[model samples]
Target: MTRAVAVELRGVSCEYRTRTGRVLAVEKLSMQASDREFVALLGPSGCGKSTLLKMVAGLVPATAGEVLVYGRPVVRPLESLGMVFQSPVLLRWRTVINNVLFPAEATGRRDAAMRERAMALLRLVGLTGFEDKYPHELSGGMAQRVSLARALLLEPTLLLMDEPFGALDALTREEMGIELLRIWQEQPKTILFVTHSISESVLLADRVIVMTPRPGRVAAEITIDLPRPRSGRMRVLPRFGELVSVLQDEMGIAT
Candidate 1:
């Protein structure tokens, strides 16, 4: 069965105008994500992975080409989209459940039913018992869980995540990766994840898009045929090692 296209970028280029000069970030990059597909973009530090994600989410405009979501041009910030950044930007004063309801409240969607939905979302992200706890009371990973629940409050179809687990410790990052996969399974969406960790990308994504540094463009595309409900042991398997090795080579990194 052919999956429908959920996102499309055509000859997209992003340039920043600064006092010094024009800096080109993404140059003529094109890619597509199928409906409910989990796509991960990987590259070095200076690559435009994050910029590309913002463009697709309508937070940034491409200096050239176009970005389309569900076949429509992304001309402005998409209300149907949800975004989670590196930092879990939760309000310190708000309790866990309140923070999760922030997005819905922001757009005036709050109601008895919406509040119940928010609680359910918090539960989905494994924050069921701590809904009333303040941000200061939560751990780093717990805060991020709140952020994830807040992002999903609107039940968006396109989810854009920019290194959501980049700040956590190695063990926590791995745990979050597994939890994210579980949430994705329960509630499907078209996800575009930006990350630098080769292992994390391989572990979560159906297809990993590798890019070159600055003036970022797709350098290689690796399809992971690994089985679903992935186990932690899968990362040590020979096939997983092979895929990671291929991605490392694409980045010119010695394994």
Candidate 2:
């Protein structure tokens, strides 16, 4: 069977109509992702990584060219895609399973069957026994797990993550990275993640697409050949360090 195209950006660009003047955030950016591939966007702060992600999500209109998902033009927010941001953003009042069910209710997918699936997702994210607990009772990592489960509640074919683990401390972030990889392996999806950390990109992505400074464009595409089921010790491997170094250099980040 031929591989499918999960996402395709053809000379896509996004410009903002700001108070001072029109700002071009991304310019002539083009890329392609195969089905179930995990691609990360790494760059400096002002390089418009978020803008590119939003455009692909159909949350931002491309000022030029096209953004396509599964060969369909992205004209609006796509229901087939799931998004997880830096913050968990869970409603404090909602219980763990209820938070995961929020998307189902909002999208009119609520039903007995949907509720069962939500419960399954909560278990997948390791929240099996915390179904009735509120967000306040969860740790930072646990809250993010809820966010991830909520994102996957609809079983979206494409997952867009904007620094989903960026808010956690060093140790928690590492644990979440491992957890995310495990979840992705168990349930495959095309993922587009944006992160400032080069090591994080090397650790999680199949390929890292580095962006240039303002008016961002693809500066480099680094393929990660590391072995799968990556362990924490992989971070200390020579090849891992090399991949991280390449990403850092592309992003102009000091080593």
Error of 1 at 152 (Å): 0.8
Tens-place lDDT per residue, model 2, 108-155, is 889999989988888888889999999999999999999999999999
TM-score of each: 0.98, 0.96
Query: Measured by TM-score, how close is model 2 to the native structure?
Result: 0.96
List the candidate 2 regions with Cα displacement exceeding 4 Å: none
The candidate 2 region of ten consecutive residues with least summed lDDT is 246-255
| Colliding residue pairs in candidate 2 | none
Cα miss at 246, model 1 (Å)?
Answer: 0.4
Per TM-score, the best of the predicted structures is 1
Worst 10 residues of 1 by lDDT: 228-237
TM-score of 1: 0.98
Q: What is the C-alpha lDDT of each candidate?
A: 0.93, 0.92
